[model samples]
Target chain A: MAHLLEVKNLRTYFHTEAGLVKAVDGVSFHLDEREIIGVVGESGCGKSVSQLSMLQLIPTPPGEIVSGEVLFEEANLLDYRQNSPQLRAIRGGKIGFIFQEPMTSLNPVLTVTRQITEVLELHLKMEKHAAQSRALELLKLVGIPDAARRMNDYPHQFSGGMRQRVMIAMALSCNPKVLIADEPTTAVDVTIQAQLLEVMKEMVERFRSSLVIVTHNLGLVARYVQRIYVMYAGRVVESGTVKEIFGDRRHPYTIGLLKSVPRLDQTKSERLVPIEGLPPNQMNMPPNCAFLPRCPYRIARCEREAWPILRPAGGKHFVACHVDVDVKERARETARS
Target chain B: MQYYYWLGGICRGNLGRSLVYKEDVSALIGKRLPVTVHLGLVSLFISVSLGITAGIVSAVTRGSFLDQLITLLANVGVAIPTFWLGIMGIYFFGLKLGWLPIWGYTSPFQNFWLSTRQLVMPAVCLAVVPLAMMTRQSRSSMLEVIRQDYIRTARSKGLKERAVIMRHALKNALILIITLIGLQVASLFSGSVLVETVFNIPGVGRLLVNAVFSKDFVVVQACVLVVAALVAVVNLATDIAYGWLDPRMRQG
Candidate 1:
């Protein structure tokens, strides 16, 4: 399948009074057509920053995309400066973004229909009547019950989940080729998270659009995303198919994340093991491995040299670590024995 | 029923008699109310339209030279007293420039053009302080609304920058702007006092000031009641507007 989007060496930095903070440092990835991918990281891990950098959506005054190339539809999006007509055309019309916090993400003063139709009118040039009907159809598509009647309702009139559904409708309204959902279910309850994810998966399939889910919850995306990118300290520490990641996890960070999550299949009362220490500060990062302090499998070379670059471990699986995977596995077996 | 009887004269539409004018207090207030309303409405219109426009411009172009200029002007406007500004207005437009009448009131009904000419200086003089206030209030309110997640949502929708601002940011900011306007209504009435006195307009403010000086307790009391009642009505209207603009406010 042809690649819908390719992000190469994206580095987004914030110039603050203290110093330059490398929010997204040397990140690179690509989304195949109609593929669903998950980017897992703790809060402030630069997941959102990397995604925002793709559309050039990061605020520019203090925040700048110092260097990066985002090729969408064979065009470098980063080349188009902020608010340029070309960038604006692609931002919502071709590449839609679903932000977190449905409560504050939908305009408080506008009716749902008007908010949805504004996108249609701007990009599609649909008339008021046509846009209204399309917006109603979109609401229905997102499973908003009685969508036609709710068209005239303001955002404040809808419940939190329903408002998020409305946000989904607006995003998919334009049939974007790539939909980036930045922690789409973070603000909702557990029950609603499953339902929303289901709706989202269904919507992306229906629209034939690629999905990029940015979230820290490993469990939530395990079943939905086909490929996974585990981020640590603004870098992709591991990348592989779901089966390879969960079954043959190579990176220590990925293993720690999997262990931290409580499993339903485990009937025994076992305590979840959380990763120790805090994420490295973006401003004063050391030349050595960022996760070295917390990594149980850290080798002497990890502290002496720069963090290892991503290298192929096995069939389409990659890991960034100085320790050999086979050696680490043997050590694990010996320790268990 | 007991409270009604305690204020029986007021209940019966008798506001007592004016001491100096030797007329019914209600009748005297009735004649003066129109003058105050006319001046108040015109000044309010000028101040609100210009103030809101200035505020929106300042907010949208924040960090620009124009925003700094407008903000500095607003700060200076709030600091300068209206009475002092009125005196300066008369000295400049009325004396130095010889552009308008210095001191007089003309009934628009008798001659519309002359009335408009007579009103320009006083109305602007009356509007300055509130205009400055509205600009500051709306600027801050608009700044807050612009930071909301929804405004970012609006931009992400690929809507034109203008539509994003006027439709998304401005509408949300209007709630606070409306409240500011409501508060200004009362301030305008009081502000008209000095302006009316300076321009020699026979509005309620002037009547109240004259009655105060002459110890005409009935006339003074009537003017105060009228101003108080107008302020109450303005406040009620403002609340209704809030409910209309944001339905969440409607439930309560």
Candidate 2:
């Protein structure tokens, strides 16, 4: 079957005053219908950029989709202009987006009903009365309390988590096929992160839509996302099923990421191991592997050759690396010593 | 004693007679009120509509040639004095081009074409600074509002670029723009004083100026009183607008 969405060799660049910034350099991924996946990367890794570029949401002039094909259900999304009616229809009609900073994601001046009903009216051609009822239904579905009374309140009236629920309600109002949640809980309290994710995951499954959770935090998505695409320096360094990535992570950067985050399963005595060094600056990315400086297991080939493309390490597992760092085995060997 | 008497007369709706005009202060101001108000309203409408349009255009096309030209003009507009601009308008439109009259106020109801032509210089002079101010304020406010997450959310919701700007961004931008308008009304009122004299128009501002020189204290007091009252009403309207544009500001 054809992939629900496929991004192949997608390149998005920013023409900054300093120089050209390869914000999303040659990223490729696919999602199946009703499948849930995660794109993992630290800040500035272009995970969010890649997701936003699919909808052409980034500001142009400074930002541009340099070259690439974004195929949504076999249609090339990149063919349409950013302001074209077709593109506009596809944005919230077929594909919904949940951004970070839920506090600010909703318009402060607009009421909950206006924001949610607007999408329904625009996409579904629902009348004012129908849209209002549907918007109320959505708010209740997203677990917003006192739905009727709160419908007229601005974003400021709601707490952070409540606002996020409103955002989720709005995103899911049109029942989009592919829901992209970009660090959806990053700006909220840590206690509410998992709860929000649960509501989101529950809604996605209930709606029978595909999900792509883009985040810098591994722990936040580890329990929810099925497949993982590990990104670094605007490139997908590794990708695999959750089992393959956690049990048999190969890329040095991915291993570093796993160690850096504090896992709930980990013993309290174990010290968190942070990844050394930052990702290369986009303006001055090296021709060779971008992670060579940060990769603890970097080989001479990593420095000499251009970044390696994804090659199969196992079933549905791929890693772009000059060295095969079977992190699990290496840890086992180190423990024996 | 004189001040007490004048204040008491004001309470009774009696502004003492104008010594210079040899008429009742109320009658003199009453006749000229329409002219002043007519000029004020015309100049205000011009400033607000044109200013907001220019600002929105400038913001959306910040790096374009049009944006640059608007910014440049706005900068120069705010810097130019109303009296000087009025003099220049008279010299050019009145003297050189012979397109518009230099002085005097004519109601649009009298002769729309001639009244518009007459209003051109005085209104333009009065509107210049506020227009520039509105342009700058709205541009900056729009730039900030568009960068906001909600605007991006609105865009992502498949809204037409126009709807996204108009429905989402403008309401928020208007909050700040509306606040600036309150201050502008006061400045515009004060501005007409210079502009009216420069153009030799018969309005309350010119009346006040003439009263000051002629030592017609009651007319001067009445002008200040009328202007203060007008400013209060406009500010009240602005506050109501603020609540309407941003419901968050509204009291339950």
Candidate 3:
């Protein structure tokens, strides 16, 4: 099947006071129809920049998508030199975005109904009365109570969870083909996160849209996405199916991420292992693999050379590491024994 | 109930008679009120347009030469006294150049062009304070509003740069701008006294000045009351406008 979206050699840089910050350096990924792909990365790992760059959302003068080809259905979005009318038509209509902060993402002055219906009117070309009616339907779909009456209420009147649902409803208003959820659950509580995730999952299935979930929660992605892309310091170091990632992770960063989580299946006596050292600053990344400074199994070769190229390990799983595969496998075996 | 009583008295034309003019206070207000409104409205329109446009330009190109120039002009405008500015305008445009007539309000119906010509210097003088103030306030407010998350969201939604600033940022900044306008209205009335005296325009500012000099207690009280009432109405309108611009204000 043809890829729904393919971002190739994407480089996003921020021209700041210090120096040129390569936030997303030589990143590439793909999304298929009706498939949920997890982009797991710690903060400042370029996951958010990759998503923002794809949508041409980075602020110019300071930030820019210097090089990229964000191909949607084989059409190059980056080829549009400016904010052409065609690009505007594609944004809220054919491509939707759910931002991290629901409180800030929404216009505080506007009503939930007004926010939802605006896209419907602008993109769908629906009349006011028709758009309003559909807005109520959307509010109901997102599980907001008294959809008709609540339509007139402003965003401040709604709770955090409800506001997030409103944002989701607005994103889904025009029924876009792809939904880019950038840390959608990070702002909410754990219980609300679960509920919101369920709502998002159900909505994705109902709409049959491709989902690119950018998050740090490996556990949440494990349950929601079929494929996983583990990113570190602006590079996707590993890509594989959820089973390959969780069952037999290849990259040390991915393994560290998995081990850091407190799994229910693990014995209560086993303490969670945190990833050591801070994530590298984009402006001053080392010459070798970015995670080398922190990797427990780092060898002399890892320090002396640039990062290894991404190579297929087996059966669609890929890893970017110079470690001896057989030795790591034996070590895993010995540790298990 | 107090407002209603005041409203009834105002409607009954019982604002009391002026001591100096010895005319009904309401009649004096009716005669001079239109002039103040005309001056205030024109000055406000000029200031808001000039200020907001300059502000947006300054914000978009924050550290550029044009931004620095506008900042300097705004600073100069704020520091220079309105009365001093009015005297200089009269000296240069009215006296030295003799390009414009210095005083008196002409009936536009009798001679529209001449009436506007007469109004030019005084109106521009009356506008100086508001123009300077609105520019600074609007620039700061627009700067803050543009930094908001919704502005970024709007841009990410693929809205044009102009649309993002005008529709999203400008609308959010309007409540504060309108409040500035309200506060400036009271000061503008006070400044008009100096302007009218300098230009010799027979507006209420001159009338109030004359009343004060003559110790016409009734006229002084009546003029003060009328100015106070106008200020109150303008503030109330601004408060109502806040609710209109931001529905969140209505709930809170």
Per TM-score, the best of the predicted structures is: 1
* Candidate 2 wrongly placed segments (more than 4 Å): A327-337, B1-28, B91-99, B106-117, B217-222
Q: List the residue pairs that clash in candidate 1.
A: none
Q: What does DockQ come to for candidate 2?
A: 0.80
Comparing 2 and 3 on lDDT, the stronger one:
2
lDDT of 1 by residue, A1-337 (tens): 5477988889999998999898988898889999999999999889999998887777776799989799888789999878888989987899898999999999887889998888999999999999999999999999999987889998888888898899899999999998989999999999999999999999999999999999999889999999999998888999999998998888888988988988899758678889998888888889888899998887778879998889998887999988875577768879977
Best to worst by lDDT, what's the order? 2, 1, 3
| Regions of candidate 1 where Cα sits further than 4 Å from its true position | B1-6
lDDT over C-alpha atoms for residue A273 of model 1: 81
With a 3 Å backbone cut-off (N, CA, C), the pairs that clash in candidate 3 are none
* Candidate 3 docking classification: acceptable
Q: What is model 1's native contact fraction?
A: 0.70
Query: Just chain B of model 3: what TM-score?
Result: 0.90
- Ordered by TM-score, highest first, the candidates read 1, 2, 3
DockQ, per model, reads 0.69, 0.80, 0.46
Give the better candidate number (2 or 3) by DockQ.
Answer: 2
